[model samples]
Target: MIKGIYETHVNVRNLENSNHFYEKVLGLAHAYGQPERGNSFYWIGGERHAMLGLWEKEPAQVQRQHFAFHISLEDMKHAVEYLENKGIATRNFHDDDTGELYVFGWMPAVSVYFTDPDGHSLEFIAVLPDEAKPELGLIPWSEWERMHGRGV
Candidate 1:
């Protein structure tokens, strides 16, 4: 009944900081926004499509939310390293069997999770081809890249 996501809105403590994070760190282009309304808009995926709106609000009023951005498999790897170089930490789904964080095999996607300046949970996810299945259990991004014969 529903199509793809058209836009997403989230409250942020500061528009400037959020803008820098989204624009510089996440590589989203700034579309446009109303300065009077204390809001900023970013373009994701394509130009003038898949919008992400940031509304400036008080810290107490900012509600934490989770959202995942679809990225290329190679880009996902670079994103993880990029975040690490910037001193940002990432996490994956916890695997009880291996006692480590691993990717979700069912969806065949490798994801790295982190938080925004406003404490909203965000993820960079790369969905792989259906044939890319693991033999034993969920694997890490490194393992996924290695199995596909591509990595840094």
Candidate 2:
């Protein structure tokens, strides 16, 4: 069975800047990589965990993309404050007309969207519970067990 995603590779223009942002700003660890291969990698956990990779490319060659991190409401607030303190404002925040945040096109999740210093779109999202039980509606963590299929 497919467990989960181990890594995501992104194209970047400068490894130094991207490394700095992912490490210092995003608080991810610098993992293994090779400049000769035009790739640099980082991870949230350690070597035993999956990683995120950045491949060096021309500025024009780098396409704009969006990535998300599943986080709790408290973490989401902290992340928003952190980004704002770093001078990155939310392009759009809070639930929109469709009871979703940034529900643009195919994206379906309750998310907060902002950009990194390099202008890469970043989203901190919390997916709605599949079954909207009375206690689960808009209640953060009230149904986390159900949402994640945890046995309690």
Candidate 3:
């Protein structure tokens, strides 16, 4: 009976730098760590909702990955500014530093993308309460709202 992802691991070039990014910048709680073991754990969305493990590895050994954190639509609306204000540049799924949200009509979800200090892609996303429109593929948030007749 799987309700959600419990944990995910990532390889980082510098453990302390990654820890600062996760713990200070992003505000994830430090669950625990073993510097001698070259790893640390962080709690996301609170102590038990999800956990993230960081493994310190050689830069060449690190492989970047992408993941998203679910947030409310209200928060999603201002995610770009929130992250940018914190000095994290946001982007669209296209990898462009558009500093705006993108909508995946198929899933009917809106998201803003950014990266960790290690260049691992990260996202803050929120699903919209609307019917799927697969034909729309991926589009700007404004277009999504317009098409959905909730134009803002």
Q: Tell me the whole-model lDDT of each prediction, alpha carbons only.
A: 0.80, 0.64, 0.89
TM accuracy, model 3? 0.92
Give lDDT tens digits, candidate 1, residues 53-72: 99999889899999999988
Q: Is candidate 1 or candidate 3 better by lDDT?
A: 3
Instruction: Rank the models by TM-score, top first.
Output: 3, 1, 2
Structural similarity to truth (TM-score) of each candidate: 0.81, 0.67, 0.92
Name the lDDT value of residue 49 in candidate 2: 79
lDDT of 1: 0.80
For every candidate, C-alpha RMSD to the true structure in Å: 3.6, 6.7, 1.5
Quote the lDDT for 50 in model 1: 94
Candidate 2 ranges with C-alpha deviation above 4 Å: 45-47, 93-109, 127-130, 133-152
Candidate with best lDDT: 3
* Residue lDDT tens for model 3, 43-116: 98888879999999999999989999889998887787889899998888887756456789899899888899
* Weakest 10 consecutive residues of candidate 2 by summed lDDT: 99-108
lDDT of 2 by residue, 1-152 (tens): 99988888788888888887788877788878787878878875567577888988888978887787676544654655677687666645553333223322222235667766557788877544344444333432323444557521
Which 10-residue window of candidate 3 scores lowest in summed lDDT? 93-102
Clashing residue pairs in all predictions, respectively, total: 0, 0, 0
